[model samples]
Target: MNTDYTAQEIQDLVSEVLETADENGVLPIVQLGHPVLRQRATAYNGQLPTQMLEELLEAMRQTMYDAPGVGLAAPQVGIPLQIAVLEDLYPIPESSALEREREPLEYFEIFNPSFVATSDRQAEFFEGCLSFDGFQGVVTRPADITASFEDREGKEQSRSFSGWQARIVQHETDHLFGTVYVDKVETRSLINESELWHHDDLDVATARRVLNF
Candidate 1:
């Protein structure tokens, strides 16, 4: 978040960063240091009317698209709601290798997902969280998980995830509980936001210029 350049230049640069990221990959959002990261988000109190839920979902979608990250949590953006958004990052086999280069990002808002089961198989996945700001770490996690939660409207739902998707769901669910990715990692060997590279480029959008959305 530090830059010595002009405020006007920084503002213009922020615009480009948002634009570049949304079209290439989901933006990695502002993480834990911003105060919202530490607060345990409140679960939906059955207060949101149907329209409100829809509006909330739309805003989350746009925010996710803007931050250009594959996923985002409600608390990260200052919302205390227990809601969380996740877009699947798995690529389809039919997609070209180039297309597959960026992980598939699909949206899901799990109202209050609880882990039903965790696989015994352990695997290490390098993970990044919007709440963690600029840090990345290698974390060992269960390879599969079955979880249940409510959707945006509080309807009951359940799903099982394997591999990377399972990891993402677990990571985001942790955010709702006010947990950062660093908590899961064995070591705090930090990878600051500036140090991250998406698709081999530190500036994810600049490296992935051709992605239309």
Candidate 2:
């Protein structure tokens, strides 16, 4: 996919993907090796008709929920546009939730989103990507952030997020810039999905020692 697109080109691209969707309307997620995932996404600029964009967002929302992931970006679905959908409905143990400072986030879509770290504080946690299923690594990121983005109706919105929500924002926005969690992950902390359980209950210091990161 190209880094930039004309309005008509955007419409055509979305139309083609929607038309080719399976019976469940789930778009195929591009993997790590896909060229589209490495390209910076084109910013939204009324390129797609409102209705068409809505359809695309809905499809992406469905795809994200189907993958059981907290977020999904346009590039992940081979659409090189600065759009992403996010939500976290999965239940977790109270202890784990408090440890990660994680909370449930309602579903929302962001277009051309950007953010900045709000403080010097950092947090490290195991992160996974739908693009590379069954793999995870410990990534350190700012614990607080302020983000700005256009909503589905093209309204500009700005908000502050902390903890897991902030991580979700940064992770999804990074995709628009062609960055992935693995790029910032501790190499020694990379592990297979099944091994996550072994380290999941460990404290950060213990995990670091065990993983030798």
Candidate 3:
């Protein structure tokens, strides 16, 4: 990637962001604290070509994979758009032998998604974010949510999400509005922003070289 920026780059970035947001399934997300994150952009055109949609989906999938996270927001990488990419985690049978017992960590690559309606039920989860860096928080959300999303081409699709899956969608969506998980933290006990990132947290570094390498 070319990291260089020109005075005219803003227009290009914005143009690329919109075009990429339309073509790349999960184009790179801007990190938190980016100024444009808080502003809501226009919704999708709803009638883009299908081939363009597929490329967008593939780009999104690659974005999530490269970021090394279960989900990503359009704004998190630098683009200010109404989109995100995530892998679904809820429907998996917990009893499956391959299932990992821990936090909800399914993968997703969603675009222009909406929480159609949320269930009355709600729960709190210890959540983390790529943008916030090291802070974790307790965010309360519906136990289940029926969400609708468009495919890469802007076609309409929907799904019922509950448990961990519902929580993930709710969390990433907040990113579109410039909100971080830290904003939803209910109790100070569940979070430690000051200690979010520390060398001691890395097992390999601590055991191998205490010299702060």
The clash numbers for all candidates, in the given order, read: 11, 0, 22
In terms of TM-score, which candidate is stronger, 2 or 3? 2
lDDT of 1: 0.62
C-alpha TM-scores of all predictions: 0.68, 0.95, 0.64
* Full ranking by lDDT: 2, 1, 3
Best by TM-score: 2
Q: Name the candidate, 2 or 3, with the larger lDDT value.
A: 2
- Please give the distance, in angstroms, between residue 73's alpha carbon in candidate 1 and its true position after superposition: 1.0
Question: What tens-digit string does per-residue lDDT give for candidate 3 at 1-213?
Answer: 333344245345545654654333445555566675666633444333455445544665677666556677766757555677787444444442132222455555566677844657766555777776655655667777888777655678887877766777777777765677777675453445465345333332232233232
lDDT at residue 111 of model 3 (Cα atoms): 69
* Worst ten in a row by lDDT for model 2: 196-205
Sort every candidate by TM-score, greatest first: 2, 1, 3
CA lDDT of every candidate = 0.62, 0.89, 0.59
Please state the error at residue 210 of candidate 3 in Å. 27
Q: Per-residue lDDT of 39-120 in model 2, one digit per residue for the tens? A: 8899888888878988998899989988889999998988899999999979988988898899899998899999999999
- How accurate locally is residue 73 in candidate 2, as Cα lDDT from 0 to 100? 98
